[model samples]
Target chain A: MRQILSQFGTDCDSGAAPRTMENWYEHREMIEINIVVCIKQVPGTTEIKIDPQTNTLIREGIESIINPFDTYAVEEAVRIKERIAQQSKEGFSGPESKVIAITMGPPQAENILREAISVGVDIGVLLSDRALAGADTLATSFTLAKAIRKLEREFGKISLILCGRQTLDGDTGQVGPELAQQLNLPCLGYVIEVMEIDNKYFKLKRLMEDRYEVFRVPLPAVISVSKGINEPRVPSLRGAMRAKSAPITVWRVSDLDVKSEEVGLSGSATQVIKVFSPHIERQSEIFTGDVDTQVEKLTQKLQSLGVV
Target chain B: MDYFLSDEQKMIVDIARKIAQEKIVPVRKELDEKEEFPHEIIKEIARADLFALFVPEEYGGLGGRIFDVCLAVEELSKGCLGVATSYAASGLGFLPIIISGSEEQKKKYLSDLASGKKLAAFGLTEPDAGSDASAIRTSAVLDGDEYVLNGTKQWISNGGEADIYTIFAMTDKTKGARGASTFIVEKGTPGFSFGKKEEKLGIRASVTRELIFENCRIPRENLISREGMGFIIAMRTLDKARPAVGAQAVGVAQAALDESIKFAKTRHQFGVSISSFQSIQHMLADMATQIEAARALVYAAAKMIDSGAKEISAASSMAKLFASDVAMKVTIDAVQIFGGYGYMREYPVEKMMRDAKITQIYEGTNQIQRNIIASHLLKSA
Candidate 1:
């Protein structure tokens, strides 16, 4: 898998290239750093409950969590806002940074978005409608990009877009990069550490297979975070109480000022033709012997499978 | 600290109960019989960020007050008391160092423990000192820069699996309670080993073993309180921990009552369900009432602990005594309600009945609790 991915690795691996020169803080005397963290609500796993009688998913009892990976994205956005607020207080007075969490899922996902707000995000927006039920990655990205643009129009120009590396249910790792591509934003993936940040630029350590590469990405860049990007903090009791009634803005395709054909099934490029449980076959041969004999048997077994 | 929980407590309770009922109920029997610890369940709870409820925020903990831990304990225990007790004891073994340790100790231990990378065990009850903990014969002799500990602690929960331990040993054997001191002994010390695992009748899934410290040497910094403050420190830790035990009892009792009620209404006897019998109905009613009342006391004690009230010890003892006794009674009644089937191992109520028995034995027996309550009463007199 590593070799396969590395075969397609682009200049994205280059630590140089200076992706964007537009530094918001240096350009304007100040810039409002509005961040929209794109999150998704997905069935946490493929092993979902099926109603035996109906041969359909029992959605009522099923749980929809904030895509597990997205939590790190939401956390990073909130953390950056906190860092900005603290920096501003320490006479590094910059325009106040704000984190607005946006999720495109069913209306029930409002709960998770509200949870994000409780964990110190400034605002929450949910894009939900019956039309978005069968969205593939491409359509999901299009819908999210439009929603981000709409948010920029209503709030302000968002400087940073953050998301998880991939959703647990999808595992495609395409939505975040696709969204960034649609927005024409420079995208960085597998961020492990946020080393330092001022208003205009942020230094981060992007995790690679063998080592970590440090990069100073300019503002407005979309960064996909891996897990272990600093342990996500739990919401305090007071924070949870505040989140219980947090206002969540709901949107639809019409709200995003986008064409309906660019969403849902019509907008999808790829379709899953069929899904079935994979057949698993297991065979075991017990090697009964002393240590030397056992080692010989193991080596023979590995060689038999072309693994040694 | 207030008796009324903020909305967070209620929400946690709701989530935990749903997971317990929907996820844990079906698999609990198999897990128990096979003696398989549910590592995945603990991982799920960890993902929920439950393991840090008591540690302060600076140490990467949630800094949730004692009340929240108790509330969560009750809910989690309802799923499986063994798991809940093991999880909650993580707090018990760490909260002391968190609440009283020097900054160096806090930085050294709290973060790792809070992150669930390490498990902690609290050691105070020795074989001879189960009820009268002042009778502990374990001695910690200051030798050069190290303290040599030699003792045996019995029935220590998480004994075999713990990475760190909060141990109490006598620094001056003559002074009884005053001469005892607390020490934080990391596992894998040369002389710190555990005995065979206890084959428990209840909570068998939770690892319990005898902790043996034979000249286990630790740095001087491992000492928790001042040289003579061991008993006082141990008491303080128990004051915080007792309510959690009570909450565990409540969880066990609540599970029993719920299962019993469900069974009674469905299981028919004499062509008319036993639930229709006035006597059986009375038992169910009593069980429900007892569980609710025990819950109230447990929550109240938890609130008292959180508030830092002077009455905390008394309240904790009251809650522990009442709730655990209620668990014993309620579980027995639940088993009785099941009639012949309740005696069978297949029914969940039977396991609940077995599991509920240990709540009275640990966290200071009900007799010791009464003694503490009586002491508080007589002291005022």
Candidate 2:
């Protein structure tokens, strides 16, 4: 019975019933699982202005915050880790899981990573380098994938990769899929819920245009979560203090062993040729009459507009 | 104008403001109407590690200073002074331990208090002890390894809800103020009970009950500092905490001013916004100026206390006195700006006015604060 139960959750379970402590030890190895969550810090305010000349954002005085959508992804990852821990406590014998938050931006991006730690992320990694500036989505995804690979090398196997469907600043909704391609893993987009997980496979609920679909995929997959997945928790004071003192591992282009050219603007496959705000045109008409006459006029107007 | 907060302090302010806006604001009115303790909000605050702000990190705290606590209190008070009082009053109860507890005592008590696992209350006020704390009639007599205490502490915040209490009693009545001693008593101790809760004009969300100790026995080791040090400890604690009350006052005052400005801008009379009237503008100007001055004084006093200044009695008293007065005046002006609407309970300024009055009364009345300031000035002269 124990052997049958073991196969349901563990990879090291052999087809043998353990009769001694030594035999039990030989049958299983304590699985270590790490979840990598991607986060981005965007300007706090929506009243952004683009420099007409440089075609760049005016970020000199604006406050920055973790991308709002990304917070949902981070929250979902923490929730999944917590669930796994709870299951472990209930004799599930699941792997010990840790949520690791990763970000690629200026050195100040470490602030978002610190925030992630303050809200239950176990580790934080910042991919910061002057050379990585001006990268488009493709190059950005490559750099992040390289950083994830570096994290894996240091912290052992990563069981899951999570990201927000899109960032507020970029809103491209492309990085998650591109990173999934770069890492050669099965990718699921618009994930709204995590149904179940074990050592070998996991189940996720992906949202579609008009409905939701559940899918079971193998371990070590990439999942891009939507904003509706979960409500993020506020950082506890103890968590904040811990994050204040927590050591964030800062990795540069050199640290990831990636070619400098492929990581920054030089490796980008796309560039913005022009940027401008679209002008909106408006027109209005007023009908002056009694209520019945006004209703007749509105009907005639709608009919003239091909309404019937 | 040159007041600068550290990055950590700024982060604390941001977190506290978020809590006030997101968590406290929604339930503030209901809590006041129901006269309910904000248990969930307090838990949230504790989870955020705010309770540990003034606690040293060595004792499982964030190791923040009095300035940090003032910043947090001000932000929370902006949402509701009643809820803020519950938070600030806990800090008041724990200050004696932080200020005078021995290493062993600190280790035993400060850790849980800092972690917010247990709420604490200060028991110094009685029917006869208001303003004149030296007149407390509570008595504590030594018997074997324990001290038997008998007293009724009135109008104590967090009275029945708190788990630990720092109570003062006269050990030798012949010595007057010097006869008193402070002791740490747990809630479950036999003969320790609470009296009827008081219905108040404002800050109604906070519990104000009588702490009745009838032959309450506690370990002699529970005595903080030494015999006859209760008065000194109480005074020192109040001096440090007075600015926190000032911060609370500033918060309520600022809230009232903000409401008035918004109301004035939207309210119209004779085809023009009331805000466009020079008379209303002048009232707003005076309110804003006084509030700024009060805030400056409160922050300066808090900073001085955090800087370990020994002679801050005058500054603390001044901060409390000026800020509480400004709170009352500003709130009243805010009501006037609202006209008849402000007089109605439907508006918030009236509630603010009620809350502001307590700041003047509690933690040593404004009158007592004036006395303290004058005594310090005369002594210095």
Candidate 3:
């Protein structure tokens, strides 16, 4: 195998194979892995206010950041790629892999793509169009699936898809499952750790409320990563500078070859009619007594109110 | 009046500000109280690629300039001046190599420094030479393949922790100021050792110690450029680095003013918020104006240096002098605005006041900075 590879005129001696040869070798080995990370840009501040009348976020003067959870997905994808590359260098013959970050929002959402690139993503693709505004979870998932297919067309078959368990703003843990359904792939939710992975299968730890279960899943799957996957690495200065000049592939609704009525707000099965802040009424009752009596009274009040 | 930052500059500032707020601010008080060297925070900063801001791209750096360094320093200093000093002092340490180092020397030293794999320290000031750098008593005698150095360097920032030191010593005693030469000394050289750490008043979170060189031998190739060029290199490196100190001052001042404004609006006096009072309003106004002016000067000096200006001593000194003064005044006024609470450590204003004092003293005292400005003015006149 080494002789055949060397005969291909690959400068493998320098440890950096040419892109075309590397891709060709991956194809021949039947172990190429492409990972697509679905990310979103949300308001930076947690103190977000919704305009009661308009039912829209007060976005003016607010900065946007990549959804906090999605950062873990990005970090995990990069880590997997790095681990595979390391293994290949150590003669384990692991799959050649790439981590591509994708997002769907307005053109300004490109910022998050650049940010992900700075962290370690190999490629950034933005699905931005006016028609894609006000997308519900289902519509967003559909759009992301289309984007992933587009990426596969350009690169190669994607072996895995990753997303955060839920977005901070929407808090809907639906996109990963919906996207899996759209793409006809097996879905793994709340994946806290990737125990081991090879070309054909992955061993993962699925986090649960009371316990964690280990599962062995086949390749070509979707995983919605939980926060405990890993601590995301900060962007290196060199990576940040590269990201500043990196060309982000921008896809419109047309680019995805989707029907106008099958995406964005128009394609949504559900629409939010009203958004309002829940009203909280504050009431204080003073209990004047000795310490033990006050404690007894508080415990009785808590039991009566079912607060225990 | 029109100050515009490029997209890249804005991105750099944003990243630094995020690290400052998320990592530095939380540990600042504890670090200051314990006088602990912020190893973890520094590692985070290194991971963030901030160490490469001022290094050239060919030398494994980000290819940014002095302006970028100033921008990062300003943001980081806003959280804690001590942390910012640790960050900026490394730049001061390695800048001599960047300014006058040979291609070989740069490749050897700057690559590691730029990658943040190793930290660097500048050692121009000694026990006898603080503002008077020409009075440095450290002597380096020529050997077959090395220069054997003998002297003690005082008040070196990042002294004990840094892996490399750009030290200056007299190579030819007969030449007076012209006799000095700079050499790169690795931390673990045979006779080189560190003295006790100094307990400082402000910027206490940063390490300061004496670098004692008793027959500390370094290869002749470690000498920067040529012999008898040490004073000039040291001066030039300081000229380039002074604006960053200005940026630190600006950050401290801005933080103080921000605290003052927030305090004034919330703290009530005579049935109204103190901000509504004329006296408080005037103080806030003056603080805001001074901080803005100092920031403007610092930015201008940084840009001038980045633009490859040949003579920028006056501008750099002016920036350092004015910004440090503004930092001191604004922090004091912030305390005044906070009234009695400002005097207490519970409020952040007192810490800001403490942190603001060192910007006036180190990197050349404000008095020495005034002297540089006067000299420049006289030469031009």
Candidate 4:
């Protein structure tokens, strides 16, 4: 589904549809959303090729993609905005909603920012600069919180933040919660189902280790989505064409009102000294015989291993 | 993914996903439990202007290509088969009027049905005659300015909820299939009463009931074509509706495959996710392969129809058979992957499996489809 994001406070029925950006603060339905999507652009899995010599992933010739899980996060934010806008039109113009997708990556990461626009996001911000590179979870959150503050200055106050539970490449589920902490937003992790969201609060059903928990979090909260929260809609052709030229706002550390020392490697609390693939042992014993013989052999092996 | 939907096709999928998730998804369980028709969802679909897709633009319809319709049906069925089938049967009921109805008839019925102001149903199957639709027991006797219809039609989708019904009955009893004729039966006619609704294994939200025509009379203009062309019209209609049923089945199977793949990757069973095991991986690969194959055939059949191609009995039957069978297999495997949890009502996959089983039985059962394929192959030889 296409997501729609507009600012709160404008009278939509009073010919304000065309001039959405200027008077967004007037439409109440466009108001309380602080949709901060922590998105990252990585190599497309299908486009990635393996280097035969070093057993490493070849980055060249591979097209970059917005992390698969993060797309759902952006979509959920857009959906919330659309719901609010639609509801506002039906006389419940309480507090409005806005979707702002924020990413911390290289300059080229702006492509995914535009992609998010095609999915119905209103604003895109790229946190880029030499000082923002090589940041760990702590520094990433610190940089993101600064960007959020700047977004608040431009679009008024924000109420909700959303992000993917983990990026595919990093596989670290820490960034979303850490970013929530930096912004002082109440955080809900592994949210599989979003039951309802009104102006003041939103209810969510989060998947836990053994059972699911339903919680109602106040505004200015953070939620990270797991896969299967909802099926992500494909981008429309018109949306994709429009996204091709969508302007993406870029921000450096100086623009975000952050101390230079509070970013990059300096602000990071944890650092990986070395990176290597884990060793996997494989000792194959072929059972080339009748099915009964193979079964018997398998049973004997299981018994010997104390698995039976 | 590339095998099924193109970049353009994905747009339709996106719209369908939005509609399914926002409009249809919320009411699915309640509609099923209450056995209530999704009147609101239908209005929303019409508001989106999707119902008129098959109708030509000259008739104030969207005139969308068949592939687009399939994409829409597939996505909608993923949310709930009953609702999707109810929406899809509009095309089945209206196609006859579109292909053969006069401009006046099109203006009178198609416009309202397409605009979502009224519902329509197709009445071809009787309790005694389902696979053998030629053996219709309903008889329509023409007397000067009117034809009186008297018989019962079973398993009519949309049944009493429809404002208009395209009915098939025997005009001349001696002529077998050729003697059959089609008529448009408007609701509120005297002697027209609905029978008890059928409680089925799946597609529960859609109303399927028998229509009893006791001396029901309509103007001679209500006849869709000449007195002896109902069988041909119905056969042609099935050629189109069969592919749509295939699309619905593929949607159900796709939902199963997606859920299974996600569960396999996360649910651990022996110190690791089951997806990491070769046995589970092989199951997923097989399910994916079948889905791709079925999708290809369904789209191919749909494209052929959109191109205004001649009769393609073999292609339609093959697509329906492959898709329905794949739905059965994929859903079974999905249930197995979820272990005991899959059989529970809380999970969506179990319901999808139940929904998938009916596609094999309806729109010309897979058995009948196989017969059509075999006959076509032998005749060519």
Candidate 5:
């Protein structure tokens, strides 16, 4: 660190004025929003089988599609961008908005990227490599966080990172919050509506089990959206044509500066010993009596079971 | 059942079917009951580039023809014949531009229609001009740079909704059919207005209204082809479009058949499923067979039109005639198969039957279609 500072000092000493870290770069308020949306491709159907030995999903025959929930995220992102444009037209625009969707998968996964672009995404990036094969949620988040940092550097500061609350195949929704944690940013999950947004803060409606909760969180945060955010629009003819020929940026493990052990199954924090489907073990009791008698017996049974 | 559709054709079916099933089916009942237009679904169709199936690739379309349009119409009709009618009406509106418009007109209007930015409606039918199209009273008189249009178009589908209109009117009434000329009119012209939405027994999801053009003046440039070509343009456009109506009939009949088969399997009587009965089985078989035959004929006719086959008017009339009659019969049988439940509004067969009635009546009544088919037969070898 001393040697590097001295070299910098010697360069400044060559007839340059004294400079401090604070004064080295000019500071300006940001009005443009560069967003990163994390999306994934999952099987079109849920009738996927799990390999007993690997305890992993067997995806050879099934067709792929954008995770249904992620379409809501894509829709919300486009809505946000449109809202920004609408604000500008009304002279109330706070931040310029652009959306970039990224997915980590095999080469064929690029189709989902094009699908995203067809729905109004500005561009797409694929983090594809053999090293990203069997990543559990944690490793997946770690890898995604790394790519986001790289994107933030390449395309200015990112205002927000959007994601689906949960993927269809992996019902575990740890990736969104985990990515926020890995990047040390605020995480807002289960967002159903974005009531207000600007460069500074965003007012969001988050869905709970019984009710919806509202939060006013600052921008530059990671947000996961539920399906209720908005209905996804169909791809416009022009948008689809544009997406067909649109160029997508591809990044490998080396490009993202991620080590092999930190991404794939080797770096996963948990291991699955077995994979199986759960079935309900239902038992029924039949009452033999007239309707009134059956009702009385049912009430007595409920009272005995303490369910009343 | 097998049309041996190419991969692209099959893909068109799959995409349209997916949209119809996922988007249209859910709200079809409500749309019918409320008589509401499906603005959002049409936008979805636009987004999916289905509207581009009608125009050529040079005009910002998918470069497909009537066959492709039929494929999509059949799938969409499965969801709701009314919605399908709205889309088909828009195609009918702009098809004149494709068939007869000059390069400048095509350049100016076709792209917008092709891209789904604007919707279109045809304005040829009048209260007095049902089968005798040459008798239309709508008049367009030239005045310097414009032609003043005076008349009304009755039962115009997408009447109040579409932004563009292709209207037929008499330029020189003394010349009879030769006096007719086609004109492209915008929806919000100074003297153009619409009447109240008409109530219908079926296809209630679609709107039917009257277009009143009282001293409506349009640019002379809007005249399609020439002053005396209106009837020819209208005829040519209908020749290209009749097979699509046949496709719609096929789709609606297929939907009825689909509901009947599903109902039959679960409905039980005499301690066995009704599907097990020979009479019910025969009805189901006949309905399926009729739909398949209708589909085949519609596809064959659409192919002939697309291929530029000469004297295709007869084939077009045959497809529309046969398929519509088949649709009416199949839907009735579907109701019959459903027994008492079929008469109830809870089931969809009754609505299918109502929708089937219009396919036989519109474009050209089945009687007119028969006349056309016989005329061509008498002239051929």
Candidate 6:
């Protein structure tokens, strides 16, 4: 099904002639800055089963949900768009903004993109291809970076990119920084609050292991946020209805200027050899007779174990 | 059990359920305890376009579908009947205008109501009138280009909190019920005011108060329909709104049953889960069955109304009457199953039980619903 859509790639992949300087000048007048949020569809259940041979979670049977942390990212992106749009409402014709969410997974992953739209996302982009399966953080970030560049070319200047700090199942907090590295853009992770933002810079507060660090980062940067940044809104009825019929922009590997060797699993620098659930064992001993006897027995055992 | 809902219907249910579970459920207990209005939650509902469900698409709504409205109401009712009442009562207030208003009225008022930019209330019952709605003494006398309204409308849902009110008043005292007329009254109109908010036995999150009009002046254009059509409009509005009440009952009952089942499974006595006991099992089975039956009836009644059939009085009343009784019984049974825990404020079944009673009493008491049904039955005879 996705193969048919990949053939008629929408928006940016027309492969048309590069616009002349005149066209760029005309388009630059609007100054429509786009906000891109990267999301993933992960298992919605805790009963996840790992495929030992493939070292991946089996996707069948389980319900898919937007990675929990990603919801906060989507909320923040929508909020930024809303804030910018408010200025437009207040008669500031500085620039119009749109929140475009992009996800890379199976065609079924399009559900998450629609879910994103149901809560005020303007557009959704799906990067689906069979070859993109079994990707490590490196390949995932590389492919996402390519998708981001493609989005930037089509949607105009992307002022900020937002992503969840990490995916639930993967729990590897590398994609945001790696994608930023791939794009040669500044990146910040673990952002708790956005204090302020203007055309050029963002004042951000980030919670670390023990203290808080604030940064005034430049625009055109990628930032991954932890949960609790903001509460994601429930889908509005109109938004849900809109999402039901809204067109999902599909991007194939061919849609991007990407080599087959550097676009999917083959693009990764590392691979998982094995996956297993960690087993925990607990041993208990019951001491009888009296409280003193039990205490003495416990102390003797603790002493034998070299605790004192 | 699958209801085999259409994709659109499923979407409506899913969205409402998300709001109910994620937004309403967490704060419902506190709201009930404080007797405070669910203002933030109502704003959330408005933001979600729930207020637009039963309005026409031309008026910035999804579409006028009573069935779709019922689906949303039921899900929300499961979270908190008080919050659901606040949401559904707005729809109730819109019924008069949607059913019988002029084009100018629809164009002027519906857009705001449909977009949830404003809330509305229906004022029909008076201090002396409940089941005998025609006994209302509120009078709207035509004076020059405006109608001067006087008298108090008691127990109005949404009351002062709503921006718009569809008020029923007597245009001719000698004509009795036939002399009634309905008019649109904005909240801050001259000589219009609200009495103190009423304390309620249940559904505490919804605001209710008396609408007092002391020679309140409204333009003649605010009249909903011709004089003497007030009774018909009120009856029709109630009929159209009955399914939603039925849905509310089903929702509250379903919540009670859910609490019962959840509690029963974990609650242990005599070395076993209470759910294993025959008495508890039978009660659960009965509660589940009655709820499904009520749901099916509510769905059918709403569908019949939305099919543009005007002769839906019997069906709508039956849906409301049966479902409310079932809600009352089921909630009582749920509390019984929970034993002592159910009666405590810490648990939810007592609140469900409290909320369920109003469904039977309001929207025309169950006795009135039965009378309407019986009249329809005998008329067919």
Whole-model lDDT values for every prediction: 0.82, 0.88, 0.89, 0.82, 0.89, 0.90
Candidates in descending DockQ order: 6, 3, 2, 5, 1, 4
CA-based DockQ, model 5: 0.29
Arranged by TM-score, best first? 6, 5, 3, 2, 1, 4
- Residue A170, candidate 4: alpha-carbon lDDT: 65
lDDT of 2 by residue, A43-132 (tens): 899887666654545556778899998999888888888777765664446446889999988888889999999888999999889888
Fnat, model by model in order, equals 0.04, 0.42, 0.50, 0.04, 0.38, 0.88
Give the TM-scores of the predictions, in the order they appear: 0.66, 0.81, 0.84, 0.59, 0.87, 0.91
lDDT of 4 by residue, A1-308 (tens): 11234322334445565555445435444335657777988788754554565333445656889999998898788878877777656534555566888898878888899888777777789998988766788899888888888888998888888999898766787888998899888999999988887768889999988999999998878899988787665454345545767778999988988898889877777766545669999998888689999999999998998999
List residue ranges in candidate 3 displaced over 4 A. A1-32, A43-65, A82-96, A106-108, A128-143, A181-186, A193-206, A212-218, A228-245, A252-308, B62-64, B378-381
TM-score of chain B, candidates 1 onward in order: 0.95, 0.98, 0.98, 0.96, 0.99, 0.99
Model 5 Cα shift for residue A88 (angstroms): 7.5
TM-score of chain A of each: 0.80, 0.88, 0.83, 0.80, 0.81, 0.86
Q: Candidate 6 residues B127-245, lDDT tens each? A: 89999999999999999999999999999989988999999999998999999999999988999999999999999999999999998999999998898889989999999999999
Tens digits of per-residue lDDT for model 3 on B1-381? Answer: 456998778777888898888888888888889999999888878878889886899998887599999999999999999999999999899999999999999989887888778889999888888989899999999999999999999999999999989999999989988999999999899999999999988888899999999988899999998999999998999999999999999999998898899999999888999999999999999998998999999999999999999999999999999999999999999999999989998888898899999999998999999999999999999
Docking class of 5: acceptable
Better of 3 and 6 by DockQ: 6
lDDT of 5 by residue, A126-236 (tens): 999988888898999999999999998887788889999898987899999999999998999999999997779899999999999999988789999988889887665
Deviation from native of the Cα of residue B377 in model 2, angstroms: 4.5
lDDT for position A186 in model 2: 93
Clashing pairs in 5: none
lDDT of 6 by residue, A49-161 (tens): 88878777789888999999999999999888777676445433554688999999999999999999999999999999988888889999899989888887888888899
Which ten contiguous residues of candidate 1 chain B have the minimum total lDDT? Answer: B40-49
Candidate 1 C-alpha lDDT tens digits along B171-266:
998897999998999999999999988887877667788999998999999998589988888888888889889999999998888888899889
Among these predicted structures, which one has the highest DockQ? 6
In order, what DockQ does each candidate have? 0.07, 0.39, 0.43, 0.06, 0.29, 0.64
Pairs of residues at least 3 apart in sequence or in different chains that clash in candidate 2: A237-B48, A237-B49
TM-score for the B chain of model 6: 0.99
